[model samples]
Target: MRGCLLDAGYTPDGVRALLGRSAHDALTRGEPEPAARASRDGDELGTLVRLFLLEDTEPEPAVTAALGDLDPLLAGRILRRTPEGIRAALDVRPYGEGPGDDGEPGADWWVVSDLDSPASRQDREHVTGVGGASLSLAAATVRRPVGSLLDLGTGCGVQALHGSRHAVNVVATDVLPRALALARLSCGLSGVDVDLREGPWFAPVEGERFDQIVSNPPFVPGPERVDYVYRDSGLAGDAALASLLGGLADRLNPGGIAQLLGSWLHVRGEDWPDRVRSWLPDGVDAWVLQREVVDPAMHVGTWQRDAGLVPSSPAARGQAAAWLDWMAAERVEGVGFGFLMLRRTDSTPTVVVEDLPGELGEGLAREMTGWLDRIDWLRAHERDADLLGATLLIAPETVLESASSVDPDGGWSELSTTVRRWGGPGWEHPVDGPAAALLAGCRGHLPLSELVALLSYAHDVPADALVAAALPAVREFVRHGLLLPVDGWPHPVAHRVAAADPAGPVG
Candidate 1:
């Protein structure tokens, strides 16, 4: 059956192409699977699509032929013989493997979840299959080899399935029994083993520590109660997210990393960074990248739309108004959605808050881990004397660009210089003459002190004075990942420079 689905073009890109762009867009928006049956009616692919995706009844023979069996499916409640024809008991769709997941290319696994909003009977206990948030969290996870991983709120066990590639053991937890049951089926079908447990966050794994933890929890910020278990906790706005983050320190081993997707309230008159920072424990380094923010009105509307409620509906206006009023009463300025990467480090913790509205690309896990390692190096070597002896190299993705002013006398004068990075944080740093020279010359061949000494000789300046003038830029470059140690440079230094201005170094 899996082979049949793959051969019939049911993969992620394949389904989009088969449905055409517009219909694909509609399906993602919780609309019915439009044009699927119209385009491939009465065929094997169409029969499978109708039965699983569209939630439409098909002739008993067609479904049986596509599945190759009826007794097993019926016994499992995956298929039911209705008076009209054959109906699907669950939503089993083809989930494409992510870039770094432990699976072969072009592999598709059957993800089992409760029927979605469009096809659902408005059940509050919907266990989502592969949705946008699930995919986003999967992409953002730092995939390192680990002894164990905890997939908190593992609705369909997608994160556990992804983590099982590198982890020796994966423990998946869910609050809802149905979710855990379906997740077990999902893992079984994918040929993955998971320790499935039923409980609220952190309870099932009490007193347990993991090398990594991941979650795409019910983070939608709303009133104290909501019907949907998959997208909302009974707690008030953003508390679910805060609670999850607050519990990280106890659950993580030293140097363990946790990545999760969440929505937090942007309260009025409060610094959002500080708000998020308060949730982090004292021993963890964190990077909270805010991807999107929506006003209170828009936030409520988004959730309503996900529940298939439109503003035009009579009840929706009151619900929207009530939600907005409640948010205002709670002093919510806005709602922010993002990914949080937390690592339990023994050193003084560092928290970086930034905005990244762009879509995440592949290899983020490796990149995130590398960025954290660089931060460790920066904190450890904060002195010029310690940095001066280190061999430095410009990062590969860095590019140097300059602009000059044409003087009134027709002479060119350099105006400004900048170094742009492409691969990691995508930061562009302004550079001066000394910094530009450092980038051009520091190709991992010589120590920074030697490189500065050569520059001093070329410019007819004393080596000590040149080193003093260049220390600031050197520190800035290293902090931003533009400069790096080439060989053994981690030894303690006897002398230290007081400070380094990141603006640029004077030479």
Candidate 2:
């Protein structure tokens, strides 16, 4: 099957090129007519695309010619014969790995899952293929080589496939036998060996610890009932996500990392960040980024449409009202979706919860791994005196911008100065004149303590007072990768000198 698919040029890039941009994009939006028109040529690639992707019926002769004998597929229920022709009973789509760390090309593979259409969406146990959430989790996952990796709730085995490239051993678990069956097929077709287990959460791997874990669980928030097993956890209002997070620390080896995508509620008169922070166990460092928040109505409508319900239909409207009412009773103001990265550590935990500025972009795996390394560096030098004695260098992608306004005397006056990063999370920090000067001088030439003393002497301020004010800000800069430590910890990547003037005034 793999050879036949590859020889026919039925990979992701090939399909996109054959369908053209407009037809391919339309297929993504659930409008299949354009693709149907584009793939009606009855060739090998077109027959496979129409049969598996579009869920269209093709003549038995064409099916046999493209995929050989159909008896096995028929007996396995992977295809069904009708009065007119034969149609696929499942969805088989091409998938490709993203570029490696060295920017080299990656191999192509195939994934199998339940067919995606209005008819299949009604099934409560439906397993979905690669999606936005899955892709985001894949991109944000730290891809360093590890001894073992766990893919919790591994629907269709997408994360497991990616993990197989880096980890020596990969284990995937899911509660639904249906999902497990499809995931097994995905791994087999991709030619990767993954231990497939049928259990919920971490039950299948009891007492086992992994160096890294990645999950995109059933994290949608709604009433305490389950409508779709792929999105609903059968637990009340984000409790499933909370429970999963609370148990991660126990399953990780020392210095291990775990990444997940989840959703949480914003209740009235409650702090969301604090609520999320309470879920972590001791001896774990965590970084939580909330990407977007939406009100109850929008949330209800979105999930309803996802379930293949039209907003104007009676069934959708009735369900929406009930869902909204339940949310009102629960006092849910909104729902926030985002990513969580956790690491097991022996030192005091460093937990940071903030609103992410923008979308997760390419190269995020490198950025996330670098962030964890920076956290380790900061944890080792917890004492103020220890940090002050170390030399620090400015990150290569840092940019300094200043705003100015006309003064009362007609001369320009500087309003505020801000330093921003072009890479990683794209964090921006506001700085005053003295702080800006201190950052400009961080070129790995002098220790931070010396720089602080010199600035205090130049400005005639008390050195102790300056140190007290600058230490916190300096830690923040280091944590966000705006400043890089030079001596004690080895930097994750080599530094290049930025073209922008570090100390020059901005227009």
Candidate 3:
């Protein structure tokens, strides 16, 4: 590799001149030969050599063009010149491999081979810092208007790097010092200054609260260890993630939001959402989106394979034993995966629980924004529109007060449909099961969105899924007068208010 650099018309000083100061120092410190380094299994030196010794790079002219003339954070090079090429470079481990096709074939040049030789980028085997969760949580953050931010268990510093752009001051914590060192280099290269600390959750940030806290903590509950320790936060059950949620209320600024991506053990015959709901601290308004569920066997099979535990390491045998033990001990049938959006306040608790039926990254931004908007709607709106709309639009078919009386305190009661055979003296029968339960309630009274929400809750399905599955039925119900649709929902009062305040919050 050294000779190659020299042959590529590059010398130590030339390489140093190419990169700024800090990067030069980082690179020149000590590196191994690419072949010798790649040969070693445990030594991290090989990984560094592979990442830093990039000579053939696909030019990012399009990316540069898209970035368009933004002034560089650093005038020329970030650091001073050195004998080595670059110091403290912001490197990407990728930890993944596959057909590198992402529209811009140009980007593939940046990733010639699978950079994530250690693990795949889409590696979802470990618990806390999985690919989708980490990147999504980092991406979903509303970067503007945050004063300070904290990232707990900031594996690879992806969260810290993202936060560094939006936050005035950012602090990242991890139990592993090596991870912190890696994160420091990453932040240095990204030109994002962050205070790096080493400690467990709350230990590092004691007596300190931020406007925002985002975590993709170790969330898996099983006992199997993987090559990368970055993903595992050691709690037996969902205890690690649950405790984080229960404890974060007091650690956040008033009206501050803390977004998390995690997994929870799904005990058979138990309501997963209800179990998870018990974890949120009071005075913290929360929106829970349950995206995916993996049964015990599938979970083990998938994670174990990704870790090279099975075919390579006899992971099949070891994982089978460990997972069986965990399942037997915890009586856990599966693991539920999702995202949590929470805000701490002094007011009464407001919880919105919905099945997301997907991965943490899918439509996560829209879901989070909708959650924030719903919180605003809840705080401002008083009388339930369902009741009003029922009375006015579907008066004959709607049981105006009966629906209201069904649940004295209801957040959003779903419409239940019970098929009618001609005319019966009393309501013929009540429906059952997920499908029956969700389809029974419309009675033509509520707005389509609210009705969809009700069905989504009842079926334990996603909002989008609920709409997709039930909209046709809903249109049928409307045609038959069993369901009613109202347009004046969500209060166009905002639109009117914005008439004068033209470039208002709403677009």
What TM-score would every model get versus the actual structure? 0.82, 0.92, 0.56
- Provide the clashing-pair count of each candidate structure: 0, 0, 29
Off by over 4 Å in 3: 1-115, 118-130, 224-228, 358-362, 385-507
Model 3 TM-score is 0.56
Q: List pairs with backbone clashes in candidate 1.
A: none
Instruction: Rank all candidate structures by their lDDT, best first, as comma-separated numbers.
Output: 2, 1, 3
**For model 3, how does the per-residue alpha-carbon lDDT over 1-507 read when each residue is reduced to its tens digit?**
222223332322333334445544453342324333232341222223233343212123321232223234123221122354223122332221111112211100010112232344334322222254554564455544489999988866767766655578889998877567666655654456789999888898899888999888777767644444555565567777888898898889998889888888889788888999998888888878676788888776776655545433664676577767878778888888877888987767678666653233223443354346544543443234332232113314323221222455856565553543222111122333543443444343445466557766766788776656654443333333333233423422221110000010000
Tell me the tens digit of each residue's lDDT in model 1 across 247-346. Answer: 9989999999999998888888999988888888788999888889988878888788777676768888988888888898999989999889999988
- In model 2, the worst 10-residue window by lDDT is 498-507
Per-residue error at 41 for model 3, in Å? 32
Please state the error at residue 330 of candidate 1 in Å: 2.7
Off by over 4 Å in 2: 20-23, 31-42, 103-105, 403-415, 491-507
Evaluate model 1: give its lDDT.
0.75
